[model samples]
Target: MPLWLPVGMVAGVAGWFWLPGEQAWEGLLLSMAALALAGFAFGRGGRAGRSVAIFALSVAIGCGLIWWKAERAGAPVLARDGIANLTARIERVEPLPARQAVRVTLLPLSCSDEGRSAGVCDAALAPQHSRLRRSAVGVIRINIPDENAVPGLAPGAVIALRARLVPPPSAAVPGAYDYSAVAWFSGIPATGKALDPVKLITPAPTGGPAEWLADARIGLTAHIMTELPPGQAGVAAALVTGDMGGVTQDDNDAFRRSGLAHLLSVSGLHLTAAVGATMFLALRLLALWPRLALRAPLLLIAAGCGAVMGIAYTLLTGAEVPTVRSLIAALVVLAGVALGREAMTLRLVAAGALVCVLFWPESVAGPSFQLSFAAILSIVALHELQWTRRTFEKREEPWLRRLLRELAALLLTGLVVEAALAPIAIFHFHRAGLYGAAANIVAIPLTTFVIMPAEALALIADCVGLGAPFWWVTGRALALLLWIAHSVGSLPGAVTFVPTMSRAAFALIAVGGLWLALWRTRARLLGLLPIAAGAAMTLATHPADIFITGDGRHLAVRGLDGRVALLRERTGDYMRDTLSEISGREGDDAIALDDLPGAVCGPDSCTATLIRDNRVWHLLATRSAYRIDRAAMEPACAAADIVASDRRLPDWCRPRWLKADPNLLAKTGGLAIRLVDPGVTSVAELQAAHPWAMVATDHDDRPLPQNDPNFARRAWAARDPWRDDRPADAGGMQR
Candidate 1:
């Protein structure tokens, strides 16, 4: 309950996230020593000294814990890279939302380099080679192209597959999502694609708790599908189970835009409702038995029952990060009831957060953890204020007056939570739900009073063989909820895209928010200084001049007119969406290169010119545009200040001019370039300024050359050099 607990854990998470990967072990040892010294000082020092020592101890402990977790979750180093024949057991199978592929987590039982002497290959894998001899080689994610081909695949199923094994990827751009760090913390060593059909050799063990739960979830989802329309069923299933695969992309987008997306996830709201409803029903039933009720402490009994139900539901929903967070909170509340202590205070929330950080340190980096804790802490702080108490003091009036008070309370709570979470939402998702308060006003009451209650009843009925009617009714409520979401989402400017802010700015804002939420004194007003600073930083930041995908296939640049111009008409959805979000652009209407104000698109290439600081710079997308003759290639290379192509160019290409090809792209990953007075700066250079710079390099230092002889031969063999539609060249620009 001490503020130090959460603060320390946060410091530790920050250390882990930002510290150099190679020095993690060293940092761990140093932190432990510092923690010991601080603890000693805290126990022996005077009052003021004790406070300082406790703060130091907390930070040290945080750093130690983070390093400890990082060490435990280190990625596996395969005995051999490239194609490998692996025998493994499926630990989990999830269908990516709105995607055709199925992502499966596999525990490798054995792996051997392809074409090697099968019996002589190394059976020992990096993650499982420790003294404990655990067989898990860390979980590896494999994307199976055809979901139907692995329709019967479930957890515990053993299969053999040939896959191109590779280490997890790093952040594609600086400040972008770090896939490698996420995977590493989750104990995922590598990711790959199944080269052929997964040959299932064994089925899942029957009657196990995990297997039973999986089967139950699948069956419930299937039943929902049968009883309700596709969209309604998907929403219903999402509420009941954590499976979001059934929800259509459009519906998902609508919910997100309308600020109703939280309802779809199994988070605090759902857990709280389920537990509260269960306890309420249990208490009513207990009261019917007068003699039993007289002897037993009803509150404690109800708390016990609620705790059990919360745990059961969390497990049923696969105990994802948010659910686990909710479960921890429920248990804390139950414990408080058993001990006759007031719950739902800041201390209880801090306790829940401390537990989550200890067990799931990686979650600290996720948006859900930040937003959930912020909202809860803000609500508690708001409730503790004198003004809020005064508003509720005169509550013993008429029913209509009570109803009005409750409505006002709900509105206030929603507003506070939205306000608390807005910065985090913008920082993580780059969008603010403009109508979130209005949407919550209509949607929260309906969901809490009708939809969730109906869902709980439907779940109970389904267990007792009277579920179809309840499910049908539940679907109707869900349909209406969706209607509300759609209506809100359809409003003009329902979602406002914001540019990504620097880590320093986000950290400043977070610290300011926490200071405001944690303190009750008038001094809490001081928190506004850092908040204002962060806001100013955000306003002063500028969008990148050029954005390139990791694959070196897509490119976009900010034209002189301050509008984004795409190099190609067709681009991946992820890239397009990311660009739109970061550039504060609506929809996908960013002008194509040919349509830009000062750009020219030829058969084989597109060229644009931007003048800044009395300098005229030319940008050319020459690759894969059309077949270009030698003479044309030389002129294009000589003329342009930046050339982005995917093909090999002659050595005569200007060395001072930036040339982006697949090789440099492979090394640098994705790029976000800004045009400075003299030249350009890149995300990679900015990243190198941070201590965590090597985390990405640690994944793969020597990527295969972009123009590997054997690879190029195979790659070009299928294409015609003279094809008119083909771009002249395409590759990453040199750093």
Candidate 2:
């Protein structure tokens, strides 16, 4: 029952996210009340009935928690896009490549609609407020280039600057990661870049513990960076402080490909290692005095010390979600040691998950939470297996034989963990490391036993100005770790990319995995059936052939040769990379659309033809010109299967199927269409099939009520949120 509670909570949270429109609290309350009553009544019934009632009640409670959380996090976003002279307090600061990214609480003293003439207002149009103060309600992420970097800017420091603020953008393409939803729940309403140099208005407070910790962390990062060389400095900081902001993209990719990415982050492995080392050392020192060790409860004392150290490490490293989750589990293990009971079980994992779901419910949807929990669960399940237990049991054996046995066990566990995490990796990242298991067998022990301890000692020695020796050892170890990562990652076929799978398919796999892990009897083997089915379903799915950005400026088409061709040769790297990922052609570079055979480009528009299943489909997209005559393009538009442009097409210029102009895209967020021999005929059919991916704009896609005073008015008549057809707004925001 304890194991099932976290599953029920996750289901409820996922359901809340999948729910469309506003949720009614009264309905949820009623349902929860009914479930509670059922549980009480079933208390007098059979065991199965009671179990079912408890599970239903848990689900209801999960839903209620999310609903309540939404209300608490309902901070208002920016009402419109405009350049403003704003004053804000910096909540956090992260160093970026040649820039400083900071999250700030906005204090809007004035705003200017003059940005409208410059096109900034077009990219993020929101409903105008009669009074604008209601719009400046939440945190905003602002990036300041190095030229404007202000020294001594830390958390709690207030600064004033002129910047163009826009609401957080939705997914640029359908089925892509949605940053806007994440921002909403995290209390960040907007993102922008500073236009002018920032002027410090107020200094960081000297009294608050949070501010002190922030400053200390920043100081430590700076110290480590100064002590070590560039590559080693970045990795060292990440290992000690959970600050990946200093890590270069190349190194990050290498770690990810080599399956050593988890080492770069402070998570379960790091926490557990720290706790174990602390207790081990404490017990060893205590045993030096045999009287003290025998007279006192040394193990309990060590457990208590380990708990304190774990909490300190968690806080010093910023207490990220995964760290906090692992800290909870570590505390449980420490408790077990103190109380003389077994603690490393599924129940311990469930308790940790339950705490996270209750506090940071949104994390359940993110990759970090999913991956961390999945890895730990798989490891625990393997350990609990009877065959694994008997094989690894302590016995009289030769030293060399025992050493080989331990090595074999390590490799076997790594294989099992990598297999468990592969599907999740593909689901979120579109790729999984092929040789991660072998790489980790070397990397994990190196990180746990050698590097981390050296770094910790170096940090401790830094206080007395004697850390150079330790830092040198640490740097050498980090270099060795990097060598292993690059060596393994550079191997042929180090990573495999898969297209995104449907939510249903992913859920089936997750359920099957959980069933296999949670159960102990022969019934657990039945999970193989659903796992196979999910894998088949994923294999059956196809990637969309065409991609459109939310702004309708960038379009990509996968040609017959399976290479993606982009509309703009000089598109942003982010757009190109995302297109490659989603199209499952990341290994191949995207070419200019006009470079493809049988594609034509004119001054006004470009046309590309694709042959799919023996049927020809034409895609027509307008160039970035001021105007194109609808009358001249009517014949071509009518013949094409897909018509897309930055501007709205005329009524008579209807395409055979899709119309992905700014107006349509504003409502749909972004579109990824897979061409079929028999495709969707009308906009209504497409809407019904795909549904709306996001509530991107304020404009209503449906007809207004007949009795309403604005019924006769067309909602589409308003300026589209991301439309930049006019020259002024066109030059405002390129992205």
Residue pairs with backbone atoms closer than 3 Å in model 2 (clashes) = 119-729
* lDDT (Cα, tens digit) per residue for candidate 2, span 1-735: 568888888877766665542344445546766876776686777776677677777777777788667655634555546676667778777665312344344434333456433223323333232222223355678878767768868888788888877767767775666676677677666678888888988888887889888888888888888898888888889888888877877788799889999998999889988899999999999989989988999999999989998998899898888899989989998998899999998898898889999998888878888999999899899999999999987779999999988989999989999989998988877788889999998999999999999999999998999988999899999999999998998898898878667667888899899999988999999888888888899889877788888788988887776688988877877788778777766634689888977677765678876766655566788868666655457767776667888777777777655677877776665677776423221122222211112344565363212113342122213533133222222111111
lDDT of 1 by residue, 186-221 (tens): 867678888887788888888898888877777776
In model 2, the Cα lDDT at residue 387 comes to 97
Clash counts for all predictions? 25, 1
Q: Model 2 segments beyond 4 Å from truth?
A: 22-44, 97-136, 602-604, 629-632, 677-735
Per-candidate local distance difference test:
0.71, 0.74
Candidate 2 lDDT for residue 262: 94
